[model samples]
Target: MKFGPIPTLQAKGSILAHSIVCSGRRLRKGVMLEDAHIEQLSASGITEVTVAQLQENDVHEDQAAAELAKALVPDVRAAGLECTAAFTGRVNLVATGPGIVDLQADRLIALNSIDPMISFATVPNYQQMRKGGLVGTVKIISYAVDAEKLRSACALGSAAIKILPPQLKTASLVVSQNANRNDEKGISAIKTRLDALGITLEKVIATEHEIDPMAKALSSLKSELLLILTSSATSDSNDTAPAAVRAAGGQVERFGIPVDPGNLLFLGRIQSRPVIGFPGCVRSPALNGADWVLSQIACGVSLNENSFAQMAIGGLLKEIPTRPQPRRPKK
Candidate 1:
């Protein structure tokens, strides 16, 4: 059965509000958007527009693009911005006068030289890249954009996508208890905690599960972080414990936080993706493992092995002042 052509798909998920630009006019600073305005934009063809109070309390670039996209509706061009969609909150729109066949090599060269982590994803210009021809709709992520890079990228046979270091979304939560029922309960508790923090957890998987199958699932879903929470009592020696992580790829880290009730926590990641292990203490109302780890990851801090180790400097030790010993007995 043939389904009708669907419109272009952009990245969908929670994104940070970096900067907001609108019609090159910053929406009046304190002016709250009216629902009527939102409805009007939506009906006019602006799809999936959502507004919320932001940490910055002021719009920046990303927010500006999003708002412009929302206002322009059916006619993105009418919005006064140069691009149809902006990904990664960092983008440079090169106006090719509406029929430009390709972005130039200089564009990619410029963006690449500035940051090695810059990457591209095949977008509307797939055929162009294949034929060494130019196309449109290249998405790029870079620390900064160069005018030359913008020109060169568009000059390519087709528009190309430049993405940053791929972000891992799959988090592995390892429950140590042998009882399936207990493991399920622990997983439920952890999920609840994560949800409160606005982190969407994918699944609670068993450790013994095969890597190939597990990886296949994660790949299909495009998950980047892995979180492991343990309830099993393994020897501190690390000999009896199952592999800390099953994935042959990704990052890993262990946490022994200074926070009360959660000092026993451990977190590991396979690559840049997170693999966190939360001890039973997370269930307690007291601040626990999930609290600290969740905050760091939310702020875009990659919890690698070294960062985890650094966490130990002030984390595990307790402050106990020495009390003066009782006076010695008289001879």
Candidate 2:
């Protein structure tokens, strides 16, 4: 595409490169200059105007943006995504329901590298999403880009993005509480998190913070998911929560994650149902590693050993006011 200043008489039929006011008329940028516009500019003594002339092989910005968006999410419904109409060379992808972002990093990276004018960005992989949340956006930076470049970007990815919706719908929380600590606050917080992922809290079982009592509670659960929140932090795999999961005919899969606030979290399974041992930080309604694990599991997203190991990066969350023991300790 050609972009530069030209005589007002020669600007007709070209896209206006900049906004201008002449003869009491506001001609916005990207507007196609017509005979009337040129006549007004001429009458206002504006001899020169900037414009963009498209070549036959160039794709308009709006068309390119929409096409790229379609390639990224061919079936919006199936992909759990919805797209806005392309406007001003931009198209936004939104989540159709509560879920987590699923994307092909390599494909998107290659798509972005195709040309500076073509851009695609989205939330991090496995990031939690809400209904109607903005997932990503496609943008064409110039008035038009070469068709070849746009085609390359479109070819790099097809249906490569989606929202992973929840598969687990019911959960039971078994909390171990002491007389000095109130369980109400933790129960409320856990309920809110589960509700967001479409999981119903079937019941809250109050039990002693002991292996035998917690184990009894765990074995009686019938929900698809089980959660344990203890008033005291579980310090080892043989601690109350992990041992109880084992005592209930379950196997503890992982005991520690690299995430700071959620390092004490653990995962186990009884029969076919998944069980999670919550860290104390989960009692507060804040972003934590447990939220990530819960959301992923609820959405049916598999987590390998590497997934827990990788949580170290970007897991240094800000310390909340309610933290019993701060990392640095008081000077």
In order, what lDDT does every prediction score?
A: 0.40, 0.91
| C-alpha TM-scores of all predictions | 0.36, 0.97
Error of 1 at 60 (Å): 31
Q: Could you give the C-alpha RMSD of every candidate to the true structure, in order shown? A: 19.7, 1.1
For residue 169, model 2's alpha carbon misses the true position, in angstroms, by 0.5
Query: Model 1 compared with the native: what TM-score?
Result: 0.36
- Candidate 1 segments exceeding 4 Å error: 1-172, 207-222, 234-242, 302-331
Task: Give the per-residue lDDT of model 2 (tens digit) for 105-190.
Answer: 99999899988989998988989999989999999999999999998899997888999999999999999988898889989999
Task: Show model 2 residue runs off by greater than 4 Å.
Answer: none
Backbone-clash count (model 1): 73
Give the winner by lDDT.
Answer: 2
Worst 10 residues of 2 by lDDT: 309-318
Tens-digit lDDT string for candidate 1 (1-331): 1112222122122221223334333333223345543444344554443332333223333443333223222232431124445654333443322221122345445534543323332233111111122222233332223334333333342323321111233344544444443566557766765554445676555543333544443333334555554545322423122243434454334435544445555555555455555545555444444555655664355555665555454443332222122124337
